[model samples]
Structure formats: C-alpha cells, structure tokens
Target: MTDPIYAIPDIHGQDALLDEALERVARDGGPQATIVFLGDLVDRGPDSRAVIERLMQGQAEGRPWRVLRGNHDQMLLDFLDRSVIHSPRVASGLSWLNPRLGGAETLASYGVTAPDPEAAHAEARAAVPQAHRDWLARLPLWHEAGPLLFVHAGLRPGVALDRQDPDDLMWIRAGFLDHAEPHPWLVVHGHTALDHPAHFGTRIDLDGGAGFGRPLWPAVFEGRGCWLLTDSGREPLTPAE
Candidate 1:
C-alpha cells in the first residue's frame, strides 16, 4: 500500500480513544504513515496528560506526525504563554467551555488541581511548561501534501492558499467556507464540528467533535482521496467538582 497520510481530529483528552484510533490507523495504513493532528488534545477527556506525553514521544522518535493548532490548542498555549488575557471573552467563554469540555481532566492527569475554579484556571494556565509553550507557538498554520491543504480551520474562500493568514487558518469558518467564491485547494480541517464528516466541494471537515461526546475522527488519505477511520464511541471525562 502507498504510504498514506492519516489525519486525526479533536482528541479532547480522550487518550484511550486516541490510542485506539492511532492503533487502527497504524494497522490500516502501516508504520510508514504520516500523521497530522487537527489539535484540541486537551480538555473534557480522561487522559490529556497521557495524550500530550505520547505526542511528544512520537515527535521525539521522529514519527511522521505533525500538528495544526486548533482554537482550543491556541487558547491553551496562550493561557501558558501569556500571563493574562485582556479579552474578557477568552477569560470567560473560552475558559469555562474548555474545562466543561475537558481542560480540568487534562489538569487532573498531571496530578494537580486548583483549590478553586479560579485557582484551577490559573493552575492550568501555569501548568504548560515553557518547552511545550515554545513547541506549540511554533506549530504551522497549514500542512500541504499534493492536493490536500490541512489546517485547524479551513482557509477563507477566495483567499489563495499562499495568502491565508496564520491566525485565520487556526480560526475561521463563515469567511473560510463562503462557498460563493471558489477556493484554490481542497481544504481539510477540524474546527467546526459536524454531525458527520462530509465534503463540500474542495473542503472535507473531519471534526466529528469528540468533546461533544462524539467520535474521534481519523482520516486516511490515499491516492488523492480521504476516508475516515473513527472510534465513534463515547468516552466520558471526570465530572467537574
């Protein structure tokens, strides 16, 4: 079989599910497979710590794995890199949603917890080690392979692939999939969750939304085509205190 590109979506601290998906992808696509993660590895899952550790291990081993930061990923990294967020939206909506989705579970994995919600959020913010912060900061906005353009979010329609802003690649929807204007490449991404992974013209969205209690989507790319190999099962995170 041709060495294929396997792209995984969401994650949401579902380390066991991630392992299962990875195993399935490895079995179906072989060890030579190139893997790209669509981000959101932490929050609202049982094993965020394990997931981060495994990803680091894979990278250290030179495995063909790359990651595109999701909105959640960017926020988490920012919670680490920045001392405080000036935007109240981030301090509130983003903060609460993250734990509600699985950020707390990720913290639990590290054998740490805050005395209170405020403390917890701060702790999570401080938990990101500098090394990890640097790594996250340096992640690419998009990864290109032949006809596929992989990003955390789809590039805005009418914007040439070469002209996509890095921030937009990580967070855009209406502007990205305007659909009125034709796009330059077949955009593959995982930010806007779907009831199912579907293709709309040159775009394929694979964020089946693991944090929303759905499957962890893994797409196998071969011969210019993509197919999802998912664990469409439930994996609950610990209930909040």
Candidate 2:
C-alpha cells in the first residue's frame, strides 16, 4: 500500500501561487501524499524567504515534503549566497539580472536595499540568510520516487540515467528538453518550463512554468499512469479524484 507521491515543480518565490496548488494537493491527498519539490525555490519573485519558511514549516509538521536545488539557488550558492557586488560600474550602466531571477525583490524583503539596482542585488546576495545558504548548498540534485527519478532539470543526452551527475541533475535543461530520445526512468522535472507540459514518448514534462501564474504543479502517478495537479484555473489533464 504505497501512498501516492505528488511531485512539485520549480517555485521561484511565488508563495501565494504555491499555496493555491498545495491546498489542492491537501484536498486530494488525505495525509498520504508525499510532496517532493523539484527545486528552484527562490528567484524571480518577491517571496523567496516566505517560500522557504512555509516549506520548512510544512516539513516540520511531518507533512511529507522534500526540497531540491534549482539553478537560481545554485547561482546564489556558488556566489556563497552572501556575496554582493559593490562596484560603481554596475550601478548605472550594467543592471543586474537579479529581478528576473527574483533576487532583487527578495533582498528588499529583508529591509536591505542597494545604492543602485545592481548594488541592491549585490548587498542582498552578500547578506542572504545563513540558514538558507546551508539549505541550498546541501540539497541533492534529485530524488527517487519509487520507479521515478525526479531532477530539478533533466538528464543529458547519451548519458546513462543512473550515472547522471548532480550538476546535470540540477542544471541540465537544454539538451534534455530538445532530446526526443526515450529515457530509462520516468524523469520527472520542472526547470525547463515549456509552452505546455511536454509528453515525450518516454518522459513526462510537468514544469509548465509554475511561476508565471501556471501554478506550482504536482504530478500524481497512479502506478504507470500519471496526471497533474495545478491551480492555474485550467482543467487538469485528468479529473483528480
């Protein structure tokens, strides 16, 4: 009697959006659904801190949930998640791309501000919460859900499924997205949001860009059968009973 697992997609700091989807999962799951987040928990939105807090709160309550790292999280991790840019050059000429990745808004969440847009990103990165840095750095790239292997992104072409590296597991999205070849595991992923959920002959795409009002979706696997759970106001791929 294995309880069904609900595979979540990349969040990108939209807490309100995520809550809508989670409420749906709670209603459908009945305390048995294990929520496995596919990473990219922060960036491109204003609620990165709130997102992590809510996720941690749920985890503390024994509501089965697992968090993985996404590329945005990796960027902060590589930069030490606390390193900031202090150069004057970036102030007026070179604007930082932090907002697109949700970093700028998050910085403001902590009462932190930059001398310039770029400096704001830098100072905030340098001041990222310590607890968050460790959590992001320690996250593994993927998870094994019974017969499925969940990655933040997807596997590289020509690489064996079991031998995929953590970096690729967390960041490889280009080739994997273009790859039409069949995969061994039902590699559930969320990094590369497509025009819609792609149904490759051998793989299932559930990303569908949750942060863009698409909703943080969770895939419900019924043995070999699969379906989706989202709050995007669209009918699910199947009726979620």
Candidate 3:
C-alpha cells in the first residue's frame, strides 16, 4: 500500500496540542510516512519558541516533513528583520510586530518582554536563536504531492500557479475562499478558522482554529480524498455528503 500524506494544520504556538496531534499521526502512519505542516507555527498561544524548537529537532532527526510558511510566521520574521516596517499586503498598515497581531505573545515565548513595541522587537531579535531564524527564513510557501497542493493559505482563482502572487499565497482570503471553481490541483490549506475542517471538492481547509481554543485538526490524504486523524482514530472528511 502507498504511504499516506499527513498534514498538520496551523499550530499557533500550542506545543502541547501539536505534540498530541503528532503522536496521533505517528500511530497511524508510522515514522516513515510523509508529513506536511501547514504553517502558522507561532503567535497567539504560549510556547511559540518551543514549538519551533520541536519542529527543528524533527528535521534534524531526519523526519520526512515539510514546513510551509503562513502570514503569522512571516510577520515574526519581518518583525525581527528591523529593515521591514509593515507587511506588504493584507496587513499593510499594521506593523509586522504589532502586539494586536499576537506578536507580543510570540516575543514573550522567546523570552522577550513587550513593555514597548519597538523595544520588544529589538529584544526579540536578540533573544531568538539564529538557528531558529534560519529555519523560519527557509520555510517554503507551498509543497506538492501527487495531485495535491499544500499551502498556508488558499490560492487566488483563475491565476496559474507560477503567476500567483506571493502576497495572495500568504494573505488572501475573500477571493480565494469564496470562489467555487476547481483549481489546477486540489489545494490543502490553513489560515482561515473553522469550527471543523471544510472539505471543498477542489480544496480542504484544515484550520480548526487552534489559535482560538479549538482542536488542531491533523489529516491524512490518499488518492483524491482525506480523513481526519483524530485521537480516537481516522474519520473520513467530506463536504456535506
């Protein structure tokens, strides 16, 4: 039998939940199975630093996994850079490290106290280890396997994959979420919060609002369909019958 591809949606600094979800994946797919992390690894929840450390350790130990970048992750990097003031698109006017966007929580996870935004940014840049920053910098925006496309966010409709803007890939919502047209390949994405996984025929949204006190939904895909890899067992996912 072919090994299934497992996807873990937005973690949002919840290391404990992430550990639980990963344990479920291991039980179902074993050590050799392919795993993809659909980004937003930091911000909002506690222990964002530890979350990145765990993933980095996995990569070091030779785990077959891919970590895609989300808007939140990009925000953290932009905040650290010092050269960049604001996010290019969706979060344009907002400072990349604005506390309102969960930057304070993430910075605190790395041992930087956010008494003031500017001061916190400097402290965070100094506190975060270079290795962690390198890993974050190298995270890819997308990954493809068979007919599926794994991304942090949905793709814009009618745009070819190569021509799709990086801004859309990291920050788009309305146009990408509302469109019903089939994509070139089935897209698996996170970023948008949902009470449960939303499985459109052409895409699957695995963001279960883990950042908002919901469960982290990890799933496995084989052929053209998917199943939620829950603590109990595998539950098939399909959009309303």
Q: Which candidate achieves the best TM-score against the true structure?
A: 3
Candidate 1 has a TM-score of 0.82
lDDT of 1 by residue, 1-241 (tens): 5667888988878887888888878877777578999877777777777787788888888898997777666766654555332324342445533455455566687665764655665776567566666776777778888777888877767667678776678777766666644455567788888887776766778888787778776778774577767454222212123
Whichever of 2 and 3 has more TM-score, that candidate is 3
Q: What are the per-residue Cα lDDT tens digits for candidate 2 across 115-232?
A: 5655655666566777777776877787787677778888786777667776777767567877866666677787777656665645667777766656566667654456676554
Worst 10 residues of 1 by lDDT: 232-241
How should the candidates be ordered by lDDT, best one leading?
3, 1, 2
Q: After superposition, which runs of candidate 1 have C-alpha atoms over 4 Å from their true positions?
A: 85-98, 115-118, 121-126, 230-241
- Model 2 segments more than 4 A misplaced: 81-96, 115-127, 158-163, 230-241
Backbone clash pairs for candidate 3 read: none
Best by lDDT: 3
Residue 135 lDDT in candidate 2: 70
lDDT of 3 by residue, 109-227 (tens): 98888676778867877899988888999998989888899999888888888888876888889898888888888899999889989898888999999998899988999966799
Candidate 1 at residue 77, lDDT?
64
